[model samples]
Target chain A: MASETDYVTLISKDGFSYVVQRSSARISPVLKRMLDPTGAFLEAKDNTCILQDMPGIVLEKVCEYFYYNEKNKDARDVPEMDIPTELCLELLMASDYLDI
Target chain B: MSGRRGGNRIRGPQSALTDFLAANNISAAQIRDDYERRRQQAEQDAADAGEGPSNQTPEQNDDEALAAAAQAEEAEKKTKKRKRTEKDAIDKIKNAKATKKGKGKKKGKKDEEDDEDGDDDADYDDDFGMYKKARPAPGQFEHCDICNKRFTVTPYSKEGPDGGLLCTPCGKELSKDVKKEQKAATKSAGTGRKRRKVESDRLDGIAVGGAKSLSQLCIQKVAQHHDDIEELGDLPPSVLERLSEIFSKKRVMKSKTLPLFLRPDLDSVIVHDAAYLEEEDYRQIFAIVPNVRKLVLSNTCQLKDGAIDYMLERCHDLRHIQLYAANLVSEGMWHRVFREAGGKLECLKLSWLDAAFEDLVVQDMVKYCPKLERLKLKLCRRLGEDAVTSISDLPELKHLSLQISQNVSTPVLVNLVEKRGSGLQTLSLEKFIDADDSVVGAIHDNCIQLSKLRLSENDTVTDAGYTALFTDWDNPPLKFADFNSTRDIDNNNSGGPEDAIGLASSGFRALMEHSGASLRHLHIASCRHIELSAFMDVFNGAQNYPALEYINMSFCNRADTSVVAGIFKSCPALKQLVAFGCFDVQDVVVPRNVALIGVPRAQDAIEQFGIGIGVDEAISRMVEVTT
Candidate 1:
């Protein structure tokens, strides 16, 4: 029930969804295109995007990395974020898809 | 329970197999004893079978067969025992040797520690002892870790990451890696080095009040007092020279300063840098410095035929004229200039003349300028053999440099040398493609007073020619000799035992033997055919070049680290060595007084033994400031 203007819901293949701020989600070009207000797609109307090819775990890590990058965009020394070794490959594939 | 079961079993004759199983273990001695007993039984059985041959039974034959098998088994056991003992003895000897080597290493370590302690107060004399200890044993051999091949380990052997020794191939690879790493580091550092301050930045410092720029203010000031400006004729020559320098530095020397210096009274007007002077300004120069005896224009890109004609008409007292990059002056104008103004010309230097300076001009200059003592014609590509031959007409010419003239052939060079060699002191025929044996022979036969001879980049000259030139020649020992790139063409075209056409073993030896005593500077770079054996032989032991100071042997592929060491050992007064592409020289220890350039590993040697800061250190400091 989150307002469409404030946040966008991103759902993975496993139906696990994440509600991120509209500004933070816009950091990723793919998400920004999907949630564009002028677009005629269902994602733009509903303010929710379902990434059918990405796993839930990978999508969650991608969302976290996007937020981390947004918060530290201008920082010189950003703190290292930990990603599980098993999830690294999946996260890289998902990031490439999202163009982040 | 097993023992009780064995007791309940019926017992029979104690066979050798049963005895072996009951013993629970088998020894070599036991096997030998059993074999001997069986062999003796076989002999008894054979005797019994022979005695009762008529009534021999199957059981008796079987016993005889078993005895024969035991005898064969016994022979095999004896051989195995002998082999085991031999192996055991070898292991014992190896252990003893290992212990001995360990002890020797410990003693060596102790001696090194003692030497280090004693070295605290040691002087230069003790350096020999320390050096001897530091050098690895020459006869020692070690296996290469990469290929597991045994090779003679020299002092120059490279240590792997784990302290293992590498052979020559692997060592070369590692050295290349080090060079690549150093190159990358220096390249990155070079990017951060000090950038030259731009002209705008310099102007920024001079601009005041921010209302008007410095140039605008200067223009206003000059225009306001244009009539009050003093003529250069009223000022002394020193003040005129200083003003010319300031004007040139500010790039305002073209027309503005020309009028100030162009007066009828001045005899000598020398602008230090007149690069911006156009044709009109040059005309004014000739008009103002009418009676000037010496006129030196460093950069005359805009100078034309009209300016030269003006100079020839007005500056008749000019004895010396040096023009650089004066390509605008045409051929006919040059002929006219030489004919009119060449009467008292003593020194003429025309450089970077791309057009109109050819055989006709040289012939005119030779015919007119008889008093010319020094003449240098550089980058005048149209000059032919006829012009070169015309140079022989100058009887007073002591210094001549004809560079980049490809049309001059061997016979003409020889003729020129024969004609003017006696008076020539400094002759540099650099990049003349046809300077061969005849020219070298001509120089040797005639030029006795020659002090400096630079015959660089002439590929047609052979080793025999060089040998003939230096072998027991009566000419005075040269003070400077540059034979760089003489053998480069020979390396590419010809294929034989003496493929390198310029200088070989005997030629190099003769040159060193003849000129080693008085030679001050020698550059034999890229003389690829100069054999290392000849180099070593000439510089071996007490054969020293006392006066030799600077030598560049860059790109001499045969000259390796050993040849460099030999040069250092023989030449005590050497100051600079440039070994740019001599790849065989690795990890060479240069002398404290000598400056070694283009050597990556020499950086370490320079840091250890050099007097001033090394090149890398200076570059890094500059990089730090700029960054």
Candidate 2:
């Protein structure tokens, strides 16, 4: 969806792939470390990383947040982010895990 | 009326009325005669209709206007032969003359208003006839109130003077006018964002301006929605610790949310606030994580004997414990913990114990916890001289911090220092004002392994004593030191004895010379006897302190611009320099990356000279400005 380059593909455990800009995905330290081009991990060569512990629904929301964070990185008084109630626990764990 | 100046005449065409007059062959006499006939006809009709049209209501205007239009429509055939002299044509000429007169005085006092008293919307509508139509919803087409151009209406459309919607350009013009008026109201309110930021940064702490990091924002969001969080699964120990801090800070760490922070893999459980946590909630901590080795619980008002017993029984691997305001835990339970878990305990810090923890329990703690390495006892009112004398028995105490209420004897402190000072890496005995120079002499004599020292809030330690303490001492350079308020506070004798009661010239110079390289943080606030010569001599640009980063010299008088500049010259690594009450530090530019707190006029230099200037450039600018 994002021209397949300058972006990274995140594959959730439930087999859903999200295409997000590498700059947007750089908000997470885990993703930054995983997508390091210099590192020889399989994710670096292929521009794709598998989040084995996350589901597709939570991963989609995480990608949305990554882009949102990138767009308003230097902004102030930003509006509160929209999140679903059912995924609050899983998302908190994901954010903590990814160190978002 | 026609005797106007030629220069004031139309450059192009003045009004539509004049344009029609130039085009028409008829003179003003013809129009006056036509108006007379219409007036007679209207008077005869008014007598027959039993009323006059003058001062009529809007309903009468509508009725009379419709009748005139019908009459003109019927006479259209005959008027065509008379060169368009219908009633509507005469009305057009009259309306154009009125528009010209209104435009000359106040351009665009609305058309309806210019027509005067009884004129209705249909009688004086603009060419587009947009105002007379029903108001449309947002996203529907409407005409601009001023310019009469059609545009789509939106929720943000500005209203005109007569309640019609304004287009985007008119809206912008209105906003600009409003802003100009507001700006005119208060010129001083233009304090730039940078100055406001600097002022906010000086409220006794660091101010990190800018948006929070993404992770920090997410963590705050997680804390905000803590009630909905079912579980915090497999978060790292450090992240979990930070979450616990946030939860406690928000007072959201009740029994319901306590389990989310508990994980068996985390050895450290820090609950910064526990006011709402009862004894069962405290026991739940031990029940969840029996392997917790390091525990820090503050505001532990309800942690009772049962929780302590459970913690002592369950956590066999507990090595460090720091508790604050745990008054509900009795002295018997503290003795039990010390007796049972003493062999593995490596660090213990307790404070605000007013009712229970007494001298005997402290003596027993020293006897029991042999492996204790760090001890901090603050505001424990029951701790007296006996507890003070008994602390020297701990064999492995490398760090000891105490702020007790009682005034212990000088010999007892000296005896304690003589026994345990050599092994102490840091010793903080704050607000112990009764001890004299003998204790300082003892620290200088017996202390060799000390790297951090604080003997602040004392009136008896003279400048000579501090000089002797640091003059030829064998101790290594300390990394942190705080000797604030070590002054003689006599009302009648403001300045101390001629030799200077507190830290003076030679003592300050000697301390800087000894530890200037390794000292990262030095707090000498309220040490008023520290003279300018000592400050200048210590930071005179010849010596370079490579690692000194922070210094607080509040209330140290005579620290003027020269000493401040000299400090920037000497301590190249200094980041935060605080001189709160020193009024003499004026007309100095703050170097880049260093926060100069408590200067009122600092914004003049920081803003005028610009940010991130080199230290030398800033110092030179200060000289230039002063001269």
Candidate 3:
């Protein structure tokens, strides 16, 4: 199960789409719940979360954080995750929704 | 120099300051007197020249000041001489020390006298280590305080150690130290902010100690930027709920940020603080999230009848409504919401309702809301014995959590529990201080499906009553059990009489024996009578509590390290063990996974070393800890 990585597409508001490992995307509880096979959500059926309200620029950072959070979940004294000041507020709301 | 207010940023290197002074045999007082004399001479000479001497005092350093002061006295002769060389001087100043041999041409006047002073012109350049400043005004030519070479002055000149200025070359060298100090100051400021957050998180129980998890750090960042957030896109309700909590705690849930929580597809709109929200904002919540089934708002001081009516009119899927401190909503408006929309409502929790919700309001809730599964009416001032009687009529009420101000007897509560307890999953009756043993007997007989039970703050129920409630009862083991502050309140006898009242040894042991396997969160915060032996026996290595995670045995005075260590031995899944006021506890080494709280004497050592180590290592480190 650990050897194979499932991929999912995250589409942003400005028609920007990012393909990321499914496990990394599941770092967000909202995404995990939405994409759970047992649950009947459109995003799960298509293996995609529309990310309807997020801009592409913000969505890119969200994808980065998904991997960053997953990579450093158990790590200590890690370097601070860099955030662009201009998009901090947007990413903050997104992160709250994602619960990453 | 200990940051003296007037002190320059770049001083001569510390050893250099003393070395130059000692070698020159110069006292600070003597430097000050000589500097004072030069300044006074310049002023007096300016007065004599009337309009001012063309040969200006350049406000030079200690040694140069004396020479400049002497030049000021001979200003009349130099003015005529400067007129002849003015064109050449302008060209020289413009070249800015490029004419390296300008010092040779200028040697006839000042260099002859400066050479007499010897090493006085040799020191004080740390940065450029080339052109030290002699406080020359812009467009003037002063000798570089370091090499004693001539250089033109500008505003960019850096100050030297002996109250002079350094030229550009020396200025660049001095700034390296300033840059390092700036970097260190910013780094410490960042750490200071992080330390404060950790301290507050420790107090809030968000961080269990040690470092915070990565998600916690991200989530906290999200809370801080709440105002800037336009909307949260399709977040899980749990995270949304937590965001609301964090926002409310941070006092950021205002009119501007409230709109971020509302979405058309969302089934719930929870705002933990509506203190800053007006009636219009409440209407916006209903208008935006029309499908909201679970709407929770606290500190709704401005939620009047108009907004409640709007919510009922627009939100057709409204089922669970919990509003706290909605004192502005009248008794009549609550009636309208319950009567009009209560048919679909399954849960209704109204707390801190000081103004309106009376016994009639609860009666209205019981009468209208037929599908109500969970009902909590706490601190509603008018709720009394009659309200309890009214609540007994609800047909499907499974979860009942109430904190009424009135002294309700055992029978009224017993009647409610017996009528509804068979199908009940959660039953919490808080601060019913007048309730006696019969209510426990009634629950023991009727409540078979109870997963959570809290009958707290009543001193009349003895340990025997609690033991009876758990022993041989057909009810499944409770997932949550809170018997906090149930002890007999007596100032005269601190330990209580021999026949221990409230939850004591026998009752507590029975609770663990029954629920220990399934119990996840247990709060016996002030159950003072539960003896040390009972705690030891329950947590002994012979019995393992597989699912138990969080246990609060605060004020259970007899619980020492032995019992605490036994708990560690028994409950492998335990994460946080809070024992506030457990004074006897001492020198207890906690394992990596568990957070030991409120054992005051041992907290510092635990915070330092108790987090992030295995059980075997912790056991090895465990000393003769309070035998």
Best by TM-score: 3
Count of residue pairs whose backbone atoms collide, per candidate? 0, 1, 11
Relative to the real complex, the DockQ score for model 3 comes to: 0.11
lDDT of 2 by residue, B62-115 (tens): 333433333333333543343344334444533543344433223323332434
- Model 3 alpha-carbon drift over 4 Å, by segment: A1-82, A86-99, B1-196, B209-215, B233-237, B602-609, B624-627
Task: Quote model 3's TM-score.
Answer: 0.68
The candidate, 1 or 2, that scores higher on TM-score is 2
Candidate 1: which stretches are off by over 4 Å?
A1-100, B1-274, B283-291, B404-406, B488-500, B601-609, B612-627
Candidate 1 lDDT tens digits, B47-67: 778665334354333222322
Evaluated at residue B103, the lDDT of candidate 2 is: 38
Can you list the residue pairs that collide in candidate 1? none
Native interface contacts kept by each candidate, as a fraction = 0.00, 0.16, 0.06
Per-residue lDDT, model 2, residue B359, is 93
What DockQ does every candidate get? 0.01, 0.14, 0.11
Runs with alpha carbons beyond 4 Å of true place in candidate 2: A1-100, B1-206, B601-610
Q: In lDDT terms, which candidate is top?
A: 2
Error (Å) of candidate 2 at residue B32 is 58
